[model samples]
Target: MTPPPYMGRTFPETTSHYLTTGTDVLDSAGVEAALKAVTSKGYGPVAGAQLVLLCNEREADLISTWRRGLPSREATADEVAADANAVGPTAKYDFVLSASAPAYLTDETIVGRQAPSDFNGLPVFDSYGEAFVIKSELIPAGYVIAAATGGPNSEGNPIAIRQHPNAAYQGFREIPGAEQYPLINSYCQRSFGVGARHRGAAAVLQVTEDATYTAPTFAV
Candidate 1:
């Protein structure tokens, strides 16, 4: 089923920093060091890894909110079988995990810390009879998302990323005439949107014993 419409817009930009240097400085080690720092942090309207992490945080929020609005229950064997058959017997649920979950699963004191064999060398754990993928970088610390997978088509996926058909309006594009010699210029832009595609395809579980759910925080 098509997901209900829940619309919003955001234009989050990264912090901007500038560097001033003479022509001699360009060839110096200080310039190299500065460039390395910028690459690690971010520069000019884009926060590099920070931006990606923020986007992932927002996406997780959307998925959690969307799932919470739907009915909650345990999946029956028949329903699981149907889901498997619906997509050529490859369908299954995925438990996307983040932060403390991974550490907890691997803790020596808690789970015997035997270092469970990796799933085909991937970062996935299948000890719970379902794939628990570690996504600490993308997901918040306390949440685990159980999502249905291997649906009939693109829309079968719980989340969708929509982009304009026109190439000019799709990915990051650099603005012209923003550069001058000796001093460098940097600019990039993109257009895209994300939303839920299938209803009843996912659920969110806050891994907590508290009376109410308290959102976790991460360092950007």
Candidate 2:
């Protein structure tokens, strides 16, 4: 049975090595930009009113370094080495932002439909009917309820079918590893994805290896 090769390193042990490390190519700022780009695609009329960006530490560091300006060109080789080392392992940074917006909520807001109730009959307890309901009057004529169904590798879950851009999330699986017999034979792999859920709700700047310092275009 080979005794399971002495369990050189458990899955958790190997995966924890990169707890403080980050992707070499992408940075946090780039992540925010990517998200902005996705949302920039005009998901709907009232988009970007509420926005959020998520990223790993490496990505955040990349954005921070770019904000502070890269090391000077006139610095010594040692300085350059130190600066880059500080930057750590960066890969070919690349990302595209996408935006999606669901059909405009007729009234663009939710309203309470029920006052109060006491269904259980507890003297100290008071309950209410469905607290909120879509306003039939507010729904525009010819409005059709939008619902999503199937998706790749999904089970019995509601399909994401809002009338906005669907961020087909991509990139990075397990990090590739180097072979070493039975012990330490593989390394952890990580990647990132970016997207938005509303039209005109997000602003993104396209960033790639060719241009990291350029400003993000405001146009979706």
TM-scores, one per candidate:
0.37, 0.20
Give the TM-score comparing model 2 with the true structure, all chains together. 0.20
In model 2, the runs with Cα more than 4 Å from the true position are 1-24, 27-33, 43-48, 68-220
Clashing residue pairs in candidate 1 are none
Q: Report every candidate's CA lDDT.
A: 0.35, 0.27
Q: Which RMSD values do the candidates have, in order?
A: 21.9, 25.3
Question: Residues 84-185, candidate 1, lDDT per residue (tens digit)?
Answer: 532111112222333233444433232322223332233432221122232345665445444444423444554688899887878778765434642346
Candidate 2 root-mean-square deviation in Å: 25.3
Of candidate 1, the 10-residue stretch with the lowest lDDT total is: 47-56
* lDDT comparing candidate 2 with the true structure: 0.27
Query: Which stretches of candidate 1 lie above 4 Å from their native place?
Result: 1-122, 135-137, 151-153, 178-186, 210-220
lDDT tens digits, residues 79-136, model 2?
4687854542232322211112123334323333212222112111111111111112
**For model 1, what is the error of residue 144's alpha carbon versus the real structure, in angstroms, after optimal superposition?**
1.1
